[model samples]
Target: MFYWILKYLVVGPVLKAIFRPWIVGAKNVPKTGAAILASNHLSVMDSIFLPLMIERPMSFLAKSEYFTGKGPKGWATKWFMKGTGQIPIDRSGGSASEAALNTALQVIGRGDLLGIYPEGTRSPDGRLYKGRTGIARMALVAKVPVIPVVMVDTDTMLPIGSSRPRLVRVGMVLGEPLDFSRYEGFEDDRFVLRSVTDEIMVALQRMGGQAYVDDYASKFRKQAEESGAAPTSAFS
Candidate 1:
């Protein structure tokens, strides 16, 4: 109910009317079934804007801090994330990751689109960083296609720490879905996981027209932010 109200009555009309985001290969998104809308991270608005454009009730995994915040701000924040179907993911360590993976698998188990940022964090620079193997493991475990996505030019609207957002052209491209059926049985193998992850990055490179990096999001954080604020993230 909140999602619709925000979509139709508030943010949706304002975003669509102002940004006029161009969506390419939108049909690439499946009408049903479990699939991952994997993409490169670019801006803070990536989370809110991507969900607004998709036709289905897609959900995303957000950092746990958003839910466990302090003060009246924290309470309001938690309520909003819950109302919109965003799950808090613990990104601390192995145990946390496992828990997050289980949560993600559960969502996939129910046949829904899972929005994930392959880069883990938005690029401090615009370059596409190496994708995490979590996306690959999810694909293999869930046995679903991973649709590569690229969001262009959102850093301008809501760059980090800026109280006001700029009105500019934004774009999201949904590329052809990637399938790894040939290596179905080796989904748990680490090397196979890396191989599949690299494959996803390659597709993102094609769509983003940026050089690819084979490191974690932290490695690129400083570079991605030399200009202030990364230009990427999860669809929701």
Candidate 2:
């Protein structure tokens, strides 16, 4: 109810009118059934922007802190997430990965779209990073097609710690769904999984026109902090 209202009546309408994004390859998204949207994480808005473009509802596994904050702000955050049907996954601790995978599997079993950033966290620099094998493991286990989505210009719209997203036109480009059924039962092999993940990232690079970087997003953030430089946006 709240989700629908927000999607149709409030946020969705305003966003569409404002950004006026040029969405390409939207036809790639399946009309129905289970599918994985493997995307590059560039900004906080990346999560919200992609879902609004697609007609189907996608459940994004957001960081748990959004649901566990304190005070009035926390209450509002919790309400927004719950109302919009987004689940919070604790990205810290030893069991974080397991918990996220479990939640994602449940969503897939229900034949819904699951949004995942192959890069574990938001990219500190615009360059594409090596994706975690967890995505491959989940896709094979869930037996769902993984669609590579490219969110162009979102990194500049709302960067990390940017009190609010700027008024910028960001686009979403969806690529053909990549199936991982062939790699089924090979989740235990780290080498194979990393190779598969890299292949997926390559597809994303071609679609989004982003530079390829082997390092993870978090690593770049640390580098930026060390150099006293701001994080790079995916503008070019």
Candidate 3:
């Protein structure tokens, strides 16, 4: 419906013509059935461009704020997000986090592609950050393979806090599907989840060609904000 119209008739054509985005190892994506596309978040455009490049639509768990806002810009943002089939969830942890995870499970239950940024937020720097274990937990609970995807140079095209985008090329690299069936019943164990997450991150680092940062991206953003220093990013 609206999603297809936007993809085929409008946004998709325009973006592809401009950026000429390309993908490698696209065959790794399952043509049918549920799977997780675990990606490194470098820019907000990562969510937008990934779906347009892939033949299948991917449902991303976006922040609740994208769905709730005021005025014209807010209205446009909400509609665009909905039209793209993104789900809005609170990321403030606690019960809200559990609810978000449940929503993701529901998407997986429907045998759909669920896109997740394991870093929890976009990288403040080009370096990949330690992944959040939620993606690992969902993959284990859903009994699906996790496909590592690396989005290249999207930050340069449309960096965070930038209102205007540069007409630059973008590319995506898909790594072989990772099966964690061996750790099937160990999803409840925090250590196991961390192990699974780390394994996925390692694959992403190799494919993305970015330095690995042991700290969380959110932590770096927080520190930058506290110090009133501009954050570093590949976009620069």
Candidate 4:
């Protein structure tokens, strides 16, 4: 009820009127059944705009911090996230990572749309990064197709560290769903996971037209932080 209210009555109408977001290949999203919406993370607004444009409600595994803030602003943030159908998950790897994956599987099990950023984090420089294999694993395990959704110019609308957003037009392009049924039983194989992830990334690159980086976004950011330099990537 809250989700619909926010999307239709409250926040959605305001955002739609302001940004004037557009979408292409919206028909690629299935009207029913479980599937993964794999998107390239360019800005935080990617989460807001993607779901706003889609008719069906979608859920994303948001970092735990979003739900665990202090004060009135924190309370409102938590409320908004919950109202928008986001589930909080700890990003810490190892057992926590496995737990988060399990949570994702449950969402898929319910035959719902689960949005995932395969890059694991937002791109620091707007280039497409190598995807984490977790998305591939989820598709294989859930036996569902993965739809590649690419956000265009979201970074320009709201850059990485900017609080104020520019009144710029943004859009998303949804590609035909990529099926991994051929690797149904190979989910445990790391090589197969990498192969599947790479294949999805390739599709995103073709659709979004972003430079492809062979390295992981998280690793690239860490290196940049250590070296005290701006994030840079050599297209592969």
lDDT of 2 at 57: 88
Give per-residue lDDT, candidate 3, residue 142: 91
Please write out the lDDT profile of model 1 over residues 1-236, one tens digit for every residue: 88787777876898899888888888999999989989788776777777878888777888887788788878877877776668889878699989989999999999998999988876765678888899899899889999998998887676654545688888899999999888898978999999999999998898789887778877666665565445332221
| Poorly placed runs, candidate 3 (over 4 Å) | 231-236
**TM-score head-to-head 2 vs 3, winner:** 3
User: Please, what are the lDDT tens digits per residue for candidate 2 over residues 65-97?
Assistant: 778878987897778777666789887747888
For lDDT, candidate 2 versus 4, the one ahead is 4
Displacement of residue 154 (Cα, Å) in model 3 is 0.8
Could you tell me which 10 consecutive residues in candidate 4 have the lowest summed lDDT?
A: 227-236
lDDT of each: 0.82, 0.83, 0.89, 0.90
| Per-model TM-score versus the true fold | 0.89, 0.91, 0.96, 0.95
lDDT of 4 by residue, 163-216 (tens): 678999999999999999999899999999999999999999998899999999
In candidate 1, how many Å is residue 145 off? 0.5
Clashes of each: 10, 0, 0, 0
TM-score attained by model 2? 0.91
* Pick by TM-score: 1 or 2, better one: 2
- Show where candidate 2 strays beyond 4 Å: 226-228, 231-236
Return the top candidate by lDDT. 4
